[model samples]
Target: MSIREMSKKIVLCFLLTSCTYSINAQVKDSLSFIKSKKMSDDDLLKKREGTFATGLPDFSSDPVTGFGFGIRSNFYWNGERTNPLFAYTPYLAKLKANVAYYTSNARELILSLDVPYYKGTRWRFKIDFKAQQNPANLYFGSTESTVGNLRLPSDENTTFSTYAAFDKARKTLRPGGVGEAAFVTDALSNRFRETEYMLNLKADYALGNGKWRIMSGYEIQHLSYKTFEGEEADAINPITGEETSAPNGFSLLQRDYDQGKISGLEGGWISILQTALIFDTRDFEPDPTKGYYFEIANEYSSKYIGSQFDFNKLFIQARAYQKLPFGKRTVIAGRLGIGNIFGKNAPFFEFQDQWSPEGSINSLGGKQSLRGYRANRFLARSLWFTNVELRYRIAETKLGKQRFAFGVAPFFDAGTVRDEWQNLNFKNIKYSYGLGARVAWNQSTIISFDYGISKEDKLFYVGIGQAF
Candidate 1:
């Protein structure tokens, strides 16, 4: 089952393409007036009402998505102008439809809508819904995760021979024997077939001053997960990032092997109740220049919530941004996040996937976070990650009425997952450093491309919004 490309050859009207133009216009116009000293930031905000941005790929591909593309739109409506120093608190509605990827073995098509509305100064309501059919999904035996458990079986009793051969060839910086490459892919990235649909509704109520808020949401997810006939040909041999239509060997999962303690291989339904505490004082929400944001959230899914399986998860994240006075346009930002899953024998799929705010990656070993590795490249019981970015605005230009900035970000990321959940040690951490190029549309939308390099792997990332 290919997650239906939903295919490379779908059709869309002008509403999608024109929104890109609209966003460019607003940003350029605002910047022109500001540079000429003719308009104040407040005046620009007043005129910045009803700004929108959208992207429709001619076609695109990533390591995970194989060959995928989509169209997305974000609408920014000026909800209120309570803070004079900051831009408008936008009432936003985001819509998207696209083919995530397709291959000889699996594919996925996704359609989703996310809407957030601010009611007065006290309450905000939001809804996120998505439907996807995914086949040949990747899994690295992390049911009861432990560091390096998914690596090749190294014990003398059952060691794989081809792994050693590839290790030797890697010294030459080459993708070695096709058989060795295909074997490694089968052993590591086991495939599955699943159809999933999720819906979540969230509410945020401001407390006392507007900077502190309480967040709550109800989410229901349906997953029809099952084993698939393993791919016969490795069109995209995951281990080496090589494109060869060679036959793939049997994956360990197809040999009647299961990764974890819990048993939900057939998939089930989970209803989640999530809540969080947020403290934010950022100068801007999209790409903050000053101030910091801290949030801690929990997800509880139980029999009481109608979950076919029960589990709970805890998440804590913080980010800070500051401006350096020496440069005309320079800022530094850092982010940290932690995730833990506990309670009744947690199912493999229940741990975490596709819950990110941007419909991007939430997995630790992915382009969005740990850029150097493949998606879910590493997994364990608990995860912690850090990101630091130095941003420099290189140029500012206008087209029609849209003002935008071309920027560069040199970033460093460090993260690791532990099976036992103990101390953070450098010996167990994975480090990656990278640089990114971006175009910011009125600080409302950002299109970025990043290239990351690590000791073991290198990756290229293309996506919307900041990596946080």
Candidate 2:
């Protein structure tokens, strides 16, 4: 179905469901989740008991992915407040499930589970399963090569001026022939379809004093890629003012494969063994008010481990949160991270992903990273980034047994990529600034909306939990 038709149906479904539930309970309480106040660790743990659940319509839009619709549900079981682990973990047990589809032929199904102090021991366990596909994933080349006048206009101009300029450049490079140089100028060169299936299992055992942990995990992942098929609608050829057929994918990825710039275009298995050292002192896992979190994670993929390719990845990250004494319910949070990949046999798809003890952070330009740019807008073997936010809670209220708090955060983000460590420089560092609105539901779930602007793009995002 067309995007418009699908959107209409989704809206109708949401309205019907909302009406059916709203009449039976307060609309706000039924739709939103919980909140908490600053308290001593013992006091905070004492108040969390019983079970809490919340489910919401996952309606969102993105510049590259178009409109998305789905459902997200979170279930939390805190057990009795008297449980010893209550003082050490966010929840005794939790489960999250999400299913979403985007207009750009991108879709995802994810199921995750977390249990801290499992079986009343110091061990914590986590499992995550995901299946996802994206037919229009972005790929703007790597490192310094990605910078230049390679971008097409975001909007068509009067008299097709931008197209006229782009076509002129294409002709200058190829002299009537569409070679690699000329092809790279086309917007279509930046997209290729990919499907990924992943399963992750992890365990962490708390050490003395419960402030340090040893983490280990394993992941099974498979990926495949293809060029888009079928023809697109015709568009005006600015040079001749005549219509020209718009072709589908078959862009940069195909060109790279044919030229041997990369390998494993058909994709294969990538089994990874991971380990990390973690130091955490955050007062709360979901919304930290004062503390620090640090991790140095290493991942290895080898033929002996059943991986089709061989490579090693290292990621280091540090985060801090401090509640301001001068402002009511205010906190300052910051994160710094750096990562690199070793070995010549790593698949191209592996370059854009960052892994840690918590989970995977895909690319440096998306809701989780650059914010203002499209996902995977930049790619390379080495990357570094930083994020800072000033968050202030503005309101709080209770509806029946459910508690909620509203907050706003102003944030700054900066990052860069390089093909190798030797090529890294301070020049051409991409940065963006933005503001975010947050809704704290119960104690663990946070609904977030953010809008960011950079020199190249303006984008908005809506999701669960903080960007970090």
Candidate 3:
């Protein structure tokens, strides 16, 4: 079965289990003579002041990364509600850690800490560190070329006859296609390996009442690439089917490096300094039901900052949430974002990332952007995208001291990338629509499952929090 099909079964099983648990809990409560106490709003506010922890086993499967397993944990300290800032932020202090391994020979380690209104001061400090290695990362060409390079099974060039011939050759030459050297090169030419380490430190100072803030940060990153090697197989003559000595060809990434189309092939360090202005009036930071968030950020990296190359990036984004009049628990959320990079000295890999005060959005495709496409499926110097979601709470219940909420979100996403601002056109835009399942834990953590489809691909994503 396809990966998307398998993911659907997984989600179905999870929902079934949750339903069973809810039924058992209800029966247990009915059998008990005494009812559980329901805390008032004031009591719940007091409960939020103490330290709390939550975590779950991370399980994920996708065509790009295969099956992945890990653990993610979050620790939070809300401080006293009387502190004045407690109501303005998600938490006074927070720490998050995640570690995972994938069947594709990929591994990841991440740690992050956030302290808003640090020590009763106006400054909010944040630090993040990550180390990741993936042997099967996707790497289509960048810029407008990516728009034309994408290939699917239905494409004219990938006819049945062509696929059959390729398959026959593979079976004859490699027999079972074992080992690194025996594996046939992907006809689509879109796979590579990447190892990366990153460190970032940021500080935000509340200007007035914490509704507006000035953000500044420093980041350092090191990245390396490993291109797939060509397959080594015994050649067979097409007509006679007789074996002969021959070699295949280089991987797509290797070919590009040889042609001098890519930089930082040997890997290097990048140092960057960034600043932004943020205006946030959201009712809640994690799952906002009403309000707006806006940010404009600029980043500069140069040799003077201890970087190997020089480049500049700019990003502008706005997000808003509103409750619908017909449904008491319905919310409409939307976001618009645009970004661009300047200078030709930047590495090709850097073009795949967009940055803001909140976090990084990796490319115009993937879970955070175009859910129907693969991660980093499209890369370019300029990009624009938008997302709209209609979220409706379907159910709510209390399990012990934890509050659980189940919701559904119907979403639409559209985006495109180009080599430059002038090259951008609405005619090239791509769009996808999907429905998502949401489970909110203690009104703080949100578990999300989304399935999206485009003309080119279908993808399912399991993640934390909303796509925005």
Candidate 4:
């Protein structure tokens, strides 16, 4: 229950349900409810008028269908801190739903449901699925902690350690066995225990007229755990402190009561067969103030084979956006990428390359990248990532029948972890920056919030749609 204590319990549940009711029966005096709901509030203050005489019709002359279902639940705690960067405090309650059907011949049909209840667990059904096509041409999902939550951050510089810096780095890498000790048997405790499950599938296509396009998918993960098993405690080296001797006499650190059970299952299957060459003249989606949306995406991934981890990659990701005419619906975006992630036996605590000796910040947070970081924190062979965002459109609503929108965004993220391809560029990058929000009711479901910061740490995100 962090995030400033769940934002002070969502502002004390919106000030106890908006201050115990009745500001004249739930506050309704918008010019007497727009003249008793007769509508036409001066054509909503005439925004260049044109809705066919305000009676409002012409739903684009056709096409309109959407269905939805949702639930999100989480209760958290990350106590036990000795300032190892504010140790422990991760809590959650998630509920989800989907029922979508769209037509204009572009076709689409989706049916989904998910329910999760942590802490004492018992809510079941994580996702039920079905699909058909084109619901805005891509950006369909199954939520991976809303997109990877191994706890975030990248380019390995390491942080988030307390419990006495992981009990003084497991007593300086395994000392005098009491079961080898790792996050316990000394300095501070609470090693590990985790549970996970995931599923995903998506599709995309838009050639020529779209300049070019092709996207694909497949994803899965199942992880059950118990951790910390070390080796090397036969010490005797001062300055160099080099001591070896852990052929299994002890050094199994944690996980050896019933020798910890179910400990493997990791999945990955992503296809971004790309082609993009957009030169948006700008009618929308390029708002800083007015225009800029030039895109180039040639991306690919194929080395995350499954259960216990596996990777084989190919990369190229690039993007850019603009719209900053001086506030009032602002916009600015950026993205860049280069990749090559390989694997063999995997499993170094889920493919470790760096970060996880107490580290985490923003490796785009899993499943395919940043929805608030945490999932596969750099298990490398090669990688490079970059991102930037700034969007604004604070408020607009008409509630009663529909039409509502709200927005806010601020972002900057970075990634790096290399071993080849000339050790990838950007001179070993690592970064983080954050703030996000959105509500878009009329557009049919969009509720998201993101908060990220670094100087140490800060990450808060709630989700439903649009982080892409």
Q: Which candidate is the best by TM-score?
A: 2
Q: Which is the winner by TM-score between candidate 1 and candidate 4? A: 1
With candidate 4 superimposed using the best TM-score fit, by how many Å does residue 196's alpha carbon deviate from the native?
A: 21
Candidate 3 pairs with clashing backbones: none
Higher lDDT: candidate 1 or 2?
2
TM-score-wise, the better of 2 and 3 is 2
Clashing pairs in 2: 33-441, 33-442, 34-441, 34-442, 35-442
Q: How accurate locally, in lDDT, is each candidate?
A: 0.58, 0.71, 0.72, 0.37
Q: Report lDDT (Cα) of residue 282, candidate 1.
A: 66
Please provide, for model 2 over 1-468, each residue's C-alpha lDDT reduced to its tens digit, 9 standing for 90 to 100.
999999758744543332222122353232121112123453373344767777789887754467999999887776554444445457767779899999987999999878765655567888899999877677655444553434432222312223245434322211112332221223344567789899999999877666688999999999998763223522346457554544432355666677776666789898999999998877778888888889999999999999998899999999999888865579999998888989876777877778887667866788888877667776788888889999999987777767778999999998888888677667678888899999988767889999987776778888888887
Model 3, which residues run further than 4 Å from truth? 1-47, 61-67, 103-105, 152-183, 231-249
| Model 4's TM-score against the true structure | 0.25
**What would you estimate as the lDDT of candidate 3?**
0.72
Q: Could you say which candidate leads in lDDT?
A: 3
The predictions' CA RMSDs to the true structure, in order, are 8.7, 9.6, 11.9, 24.0
Model 1 poorest ten-residue lDDT run? 31-40
When 2 and 4 are scored with lDDT, the better candidate is 2
Q: Write one digit per residue (lDDT tens) for candidate 3, span 1-468.
A: 999999758744543332222224544433232111122243245245556777889887754567999998877676555544445567666778899999977899999878765654567788999999986667766666665534421122532223235434433433223333443334323567789999999998877555678999999999888764553434565558876643343455565666787666677898999999988877666788778899999999999999997899999999998878765468899999999999886777777778987788978788898878778877888989899999998988787777778999989999999889777778678888899999987766788999988766678898877887
lDDT of 4: 0.37
1-468 in candidate 4: lDDT tens per residue? 689999768844643332232224223331121121121232222112111111111112211123332233221121122211111101111222233323433232233322211121221122323333321211101112211212211111333422233223333332343444332222111233333343444333334333233444444544444332342223223346664333222212233223442112222322222233333322222122233334443323334332334444444555555566775556676766565434544333332222110111223333134433444434354566677778787777775555566888878777756556575677635566777887654332456677866433465765555444
For candidate 4, the 10 contiguous residues with the lowest summed lDDT are: 49-58
Clashes of 4: 43
Q: Evaluate residue 96 in candidate 2 and report its C-alpha lDDT on the 0 to 100 scale.
A: 90
